[model samples]
Structures are given as structure tokens and as C-alpha cells.
Target: MREFVVQQNQSHSVLITGSTSGIGLAIAHCFARAGHHVMLHGLADNETADALRAAFAGYPGNQGFSSADIASEAGCAQLVADTREAIGNPSILINNAGIQHTAAAHEFPSDKWHQILSINLSASFFLCRELLPAMRAARWGRIINVASVHGLVASENKSAYCAAKHGLVGLTKVLALENADHNITANAICPGWVETPLIQPQIEHIAREQQIDLETARAELVGAKQPMARATSPDAIGELALYLCGDFAGTITGAALPVDGGWSAQ
Candidate 1:
């Protein structure tokens, strides 16, 4: 595991969608550890939300949580407004909420397709649309989208996910260009085979369908595209996110960075 050192002096209010768990939660913690106020948004019960809030109590900056459905424009707008009221305008936004459905394109359910696109792609647009003004007014902001390797390569059964992630990458580029002079940077992080709750069901299904043990199924899945033969850690993604929001990365914008364990090399 690589060590992450938090820079001591700088801080910003950050809002991360789908931050109750998985990669989003990890990113939220990264910002909080850096002394930034973090507003977490996700679908979680009151108990889980409270636990997440309590987990951040040790951080220097304020921490807030919201259980808003971000799959629609109204929900995304309300989330931004609530975050601003709770912790001030977020100078950083991480669009990490996503849903996945797998099937042949012809066999994919229409409703599932729409749901995936709405949450994975449209929500990012809505959040960006609503939050960009604040960042522009302030003259400084960071927008990081958590895309997937599927954004760059085709997979057999992930049409909606791939399309949404690809769209997100494109959106990131446009935002970066439009905001270049405003001291705001937009980028996408493409990760491969990360161990998160989102991927657990797939892993189990692979095990059951292939009639293999869990470890074998895991190995086969990771080996199919990832040369590292392991899932990328959420913390690794979080650390990269933190780095991108720092002064050192001010000039790096509109880049689709692949932290994919060499999967893209293929």
C-alpha cells in the first residue's frame, strides 16, 4: 500500500455524491483528512448516515450528510442547496454515484437503461450545472468524476455503464475547457476492478455461474483485464483525488486518468 500524506495548510468545502460507502466514501474521507469540510450525499438509512457523520467527527473541518436521491435534476439541485446551507458552497465536487446493469444491448431492459443513464451520467450534469456558478464566482474549484475503464473500452454486457462513463469523460473535458481561466479543473478517474460493494454481486454471480470458488472467480475476473491480478483499492483512488485537488495539480485538467492496474495497456 502506498502512503498518503495530507498537506497541512489548504482546505475547501467539498461535496461528494454517493459517499455513504465505497469509492465515494473513501474520497470524502480524503478531503476531510486534509482539513476540508465534507458534505456527503447518498441513499442511506438514518442509522448509516449518522454513523458516517460520526466517523468524520475527528476531522478538523465540518462534516455533513444528506440522503438525497441524485438521479434527477430536482434532487441534484436540492442536494447542492442543502450542502451550501450546511457547510457553505462546495469548492470541490466529486460525481461518484453510479448504477450498473449488465445484458446484451438488445436484451437490456429499457427502464434499467434509463435508470443507469440518469444516475451515472445525467446526475453529474445536473450537479455540475448547479455547482459551477459557485465555483466560477469564487474563482477556484475542482470537479472529479469517477468513471470506469469501460469508458475507454467495450465490454460484453455493460452498454449503459460504458455509455454513461464515456459521456462523463466528455463532460469533464468540456467543463475543464470552459472553466480553464476560472481556476477550476475538471477531470475523470477511470478505475478497473475496484473492490467495492457495487462489484460484490457480480463477483458472487461469477462464482455461482462459473461453478468456481470465490477466490478463483475473483482471480479470473481481475485477470481478464487487469494485469495487476488484484482489485484496485478505494484508498488509492481517494489519494489520487486528493492529489488532483491540490496546488501541485493546478495545471492538470481535462485528463482521463486511468488508475486501472495496467488494464488499459491492453
Candidate 2:
């Protein structure tokens, strides 16, 4: 156990996975706007990475992009190496990359189950292992895991997703406890019904199957679990991530904070 460093309002170097689009993109923007140098990561080609990097040119701090595959332990290490080369060692790490598949537990494909766990759960572990040393040395760090509301509650036909997210929540708690005295806070943000491109196909399928308009389909999809009858915006989740990294939230660790429109309340 070591003493905690009270860091505030200082520009930090950040690494965000799955940041080419969706929720990850939103979170990247928030941190960049706040003057933190950001390393945006995803599985994209050079051209796409350049375009993504250009999009952040207007931000106050530096932005870098990487398409490093985080599906393996080596890939995760490579991503951390690239980030260190691009923007100093990242003081902030956001594990936002995940994939989903729908099938009953009995019908779930073994390959899909392994893939989901590798990317969603194991990649985070690898990255944390790679980054924790520097953070502990510096005596200040923030780790925000973008887990799902399913991490807090179960959902049928999402066995792999549920398992990965739930494991991620458990991991967050352990990281928090291990680093409590080192000033590195670890927390998970559990979002439900976010209107990302990832879920657009499901929404369309619901609309077609229910014989309803897209707007109605959207409502029904969200209303099924979330009590607010609307999806949470990616920006809202981004704001929460930003706040968690701030001085006021220094002591808030090991929390599975839900931004699920009260879905977890039900």
C-alpha cells in the first residue's frame, strides 16, 4: 500500500479502445475537449485511422489513432506500446470495446463465447496489467470500464455478453481494491439501451418482426427493460466518464454506476 496522489485539472494522456465509432468515440471527444491527449483505438485500416484522427484535430489536446487488435494478449500489449510511443504513457484507460451475439445458453456457439470473453474481458485485463505499473509509479490513474447494464442484471439470449460484462464488473472491484492506496481508481459504467450502430440491426429486426414503425420499435426495445422509455445517449455516458476522472470523483472507486434509465431499478 502506498499514499494516494491528489491530482486535479492536469492534462492527462488517455487511451480508449473501440473508439472509431459509437460510445467510444463520444467518450474520446469528451476527454480530448478537456485537454487530455487521447489515443483512439479500433480495428481499422490506415485510411480510416487517418480520417478518425482528422476528426479530432479541433480538440484542444493531441490525438493519436491505432488499429491494434486487442483480441489477444500480444495484441493488447502492442496497443499499449503504440499508445506510449504516440502520446506519453496513458494515465487514463477506457475499456469500451465489446461485441455481442444473441442466442440461448444452450444454443450459444463456443467460438463466439470465447471471442466475446477475449475482447470484452481478457483484453481489459491485459491492458490493465500493462498500464498499472506506470500508473502506480506515477501515483495517479483512472480506469473506466464501459460495461453494460447486463453486467449488473441478466438478460436472456445474451449469455456471452452477460457473462463477459459481469466478469468485467468483478474485475473492476478487484482492481480498485488492489490499487486503492496507489491513487488509481477503477470503476465500471453500465449503460443500457444506448442508440449505437451496433444495436441498429436489432432495432430494425424488432421493427420488422413487430410490424411497427422504426420510432415505435425503438421505444418498445428500450421500454422492454429501461423504465424511462428512451435510450441513453452516448454523450451522456461520455460525460459520466469525464466526471469520474475529475477531482470530485477521486474517491469514487469500485462502483458499477448505472446509466440505464433505471433499468437496473426494475
RMSD of each: 4.1, 2.2
lDDT of 2 by residue, 1-266 (tens): 11333356778999999999999999999999899999999999889988988899998888888888999999999999999999989999999999988899999999999999999999999999999999999888999999999999998999999999999999999999999998889999999989788778878999999899989988988898888989888999999999999878989999999999899998
TM-scores, all models, native as reference: 0.93, 0.96
Residue 15, model 1: lDDT of 92
User: What would you estimate as the lDDT of candidate 2?
Assistant: 0.93
TM-score of 1: 0.93
- What lDDT score goes with residue 17 in model 2? 98
Off-target runs (Cα >4 Å) in candidate 1 are 1-9, 204-213
- Tens digit of lDDT per residue, candidate 1, span 1-266? 01112422357889999898899999988889888999998999999988988899999999888888888889998999899998998889999999888999999999999999999999999999999998898778899999989877778899999999999999999999999998789999999999887777777899999899988888888888889888988999999999999767888999999988899889
Best by TM-score: 2
Query: Model 1: how far is 202 from its true place, Å?
Result: 3.9
Candidate 2 residue 45 C-alpha distance from true site, Å: 1.8
By summed lDDT, the worst window of 10 consecutive residues in model 1 runs over: 1-10
Position 120, candidate 2: lDDT: 95
